[model samples]
Target chain A: MSLLEVRNLKHKFRDGTEALRGVSFKVNSGDFIILAGKNGSGKTVLIRHLNGLYIPSEGEIFFEGKPIHKQIKWVRQNIGMVFQDADSQIVSQTVWNDTAFGPENLRLPKADIEKRVSNALLAVGMMELKDHSPHNLSGGEKRKLAIAGILAMDPRIIILDEPFTNLDYTGIIDILGQIVKLHKSGHTIICVTHEIEKVLYHSNRLIIMDRGLIAEDTLPEKGIFNTHKYGITPPMEEREGIEIVRDMTWLK
Target chain B: MAEITVFHFQAGNTLIYRLNTKLKLLLLLIYSFSIYQLSLKGVLFLSAFIFIAVSGTLTKPAGLIRQMKGFIFILILIVAASMTSVTGDPLFTGLPFPTREGLLSGMLAGWRFVMIIILGLIFTTTTRPNQIHAAVGEILKPFPLVNESAIAARMSLTIMFIPILMDMLNEIREARKARYIEGSRNPVKNISTITVPLISGVILRAGETSMAMESRLYSGALPGTKQAVQRKEYLLFAACLVPVVPAFLL
Candidate 1:
């Protein structure tokens, strides 16, 4: 059995608009799925459903062969989501406070919470600013703090929506490396982005969404064609002088 | 982004900075309500002491005065009004409006308010918001019929989001400027454009905050992390009272 399976998921907003028509997919352990789509293409809406943030209008989602709705708390505990907007996801004052929020919510022991928060901040290279206020952080720092907040929860499946948004070049490299590291460390990841080229070489599978439907679900090599048709920019062809490095690794 | 440090926390590791947050929070509440009892001279002494000691966390005296110039302006207005309205012995030979007693009274009242504000600055600059949040939870635990953790969580978030909302408003202003629609002769029209977007954005932010909280498994109560009050907290509390009690007595 697959780790997570979505069956014909559908959702309609109160404004008479369907955000997700009928989407289905299965995610296995250690799969790094890159969800790519244009604006208003239901990529975000679909990922939100995976973590039980939104109830599907008509369909069932299962985790480990059990219905998600029956045990959404478990689903949420297992699937951590980093939102597209870093500012929106930030609900705490300090870096350490925000990072500890997830573990604290689980009512873990004080020692456990502290160790988890410290490790998470260390993982994201934010331990130096542990006591600093979250609002004063730069865009890239805020993004990293958001990721650390989810990391403290130690979820098995991590979902990132436009994680590269508003990041500088170094920030992009740093975050992409972190995502790849998470995948290599046995955490399943689903990263949604329009900037496919930055993450294409790292992701194993590609899932494209268009008009609230899964336009294509295939390997990254084959799905490059599907991205362009769905209004996403395909990875640039190797320049005349520069060579593509297929064996490039982003570890550490 | 604008960075205002009037009441914002600054990280430090000085001896005073290491004071327990519970001690600072308790002192803050006590001084806030009891400032009127302190003599004007005592208030002045306390303010000067805070200015000198908190140089590590807060700006210098001159910088603080500059940042609080508007407040000083209000104080001047109050003194001027008292001089003109009250009947007292004149300070100058020919200036009957400038009375010494009215000036003293005005200064006394104004300094009371200023002293409380300065104490608040001291409290915030030394203590982290999370520390204050936890302290508030500890303080509210004794009271019945109150969800201490929930209220503490709300209060902390409210304090932290002030700068964020300010940033959002600044973004809206910049966006307006970029579109070249920021300059309207009609004050109402100009204010409306900013106000409409700000209110809507705040509403959207409120929704987002709730979803974020929910996603993190927040179940109407924060996790318990309270520890035993230390001997140093008690010592600090007593050390603070020793100065203030004598200030009121003498």
Candidate 2:
């Protein structure tokens, strides 16, 4: 069963610009769906609607069959969104403080907040930078910190918008590895990005959004349109995805 | 306890900085109220405040002076204006501006303003924003209507960001300058462009910060039980009001 359902989602800005036009899609838990679109294609507007960042101008968004509007905060607690800009997502002075933001907002006990913050930082390999000022962090570190902030909330579904932007090869690998880990660990992941190569490697399903509509949705193995080059760079040598873990942690 | 920065508070250990924020807050009120009430005693107290502020400058006098110059100028202006009309007495009233009553009143006003400035600077410079916010949260915990921690956090943010805002303003000014020729002068247009971008930029930055804060779980509440704690500290705080009572009565 789908964990999230968007039925005929439409969003129009106050200036009368229709950013999303009847976009609809769904994903079950543990499914990594890539939302691909060109600039101004309503990728962001559609994702923002899922978390009540912007209410749909029309149609409905459901989290496990429950209407999004009915319980905005509760639904938001289950869905974590990482915006395109790291600067926009990071508000705290320290890295740990920034990571602890979402869980703190959830009014978790102080000790739990601290634990989640540490665990989240550990998950992103940012524990060493916990005390550093977020503004002083490098671009990749800031991205990881942003993800860590969401992870601290322990959201079941993580939505990332252009997660690979401003990242180098190593940074890209680090983040993608974490995304795969998150998906494998039972979290539904919906990422909006045009970087088809990374999406193809990391995502089980692909949902291409064009002008706020789901232009194409298919499994990675289906080879829709033979856009292999457009998809993610396949692993250098696949060992059932075990090499990624070994390479990342240097485990036997 | 004070940091090297003029208005920025230091977080590390220091006896004066470590004193209860509520106590410092009370001292500020008492200090201001005493100066507001005019008598020989009040004048002496105000003079002592000036001396302390002046002595503080010995370590980095220029910083303190630079911080005070704007307020000093305004105070000087107020005193000068009042001096002109202090006609009942001949003390410092020889100029067209000075009168006996106006001179006395202006001097008192000037002294009061200075005292308030010095005390305020000391508190702000010595206290960290986090501590201030935490103290505010602790103090306001009693009132059901207020979320003290959030208020404290916001207070900290305002304290921390004011300088950042000022820096952004300076950047905006510099940007405006670069747009124009070296010797050309168009203050009105220059100010328009400068102010417009500064306001917009600050607003946008503020919106982003608020969103970030909101996303992190800053529901703007003090992060503890709403149940009121024992009233001992509050009682002591209220008791600190004794000094101000006499001033107000007088």
Give one clash count per candidate, in the order shown. Answer: 0, 18
Tell how far residue B51 is off in model 2, in angstroms. 12
Q: Where does candidate 2 chain A have its weakest 10-residue lDDT segment?
A: A243-252
Top-DockQ structure, candidate number: 1
User: Candidate 2 lDDT, tens digit per residue, A21-69?
Assistant: 8987787878888877678878888887888777788899889889988
lDDT of 1 at A40: 98
TM-score of chain A of 2: 0.87
lDDT of 1: 0.80
In the range A1-252, model 1's lDDT, one tens digit per residue, is 999999999999999899999999999999999898999999988988888889899998999999988988788889999988888888776788889888988888889999999999988899999988776787788888988999999999999999999888877888888888788888999999988877877888889999999999999888876566889865645678774433323323
The candidates score, on chain A by TM-score, as follows 0.93, 0.87
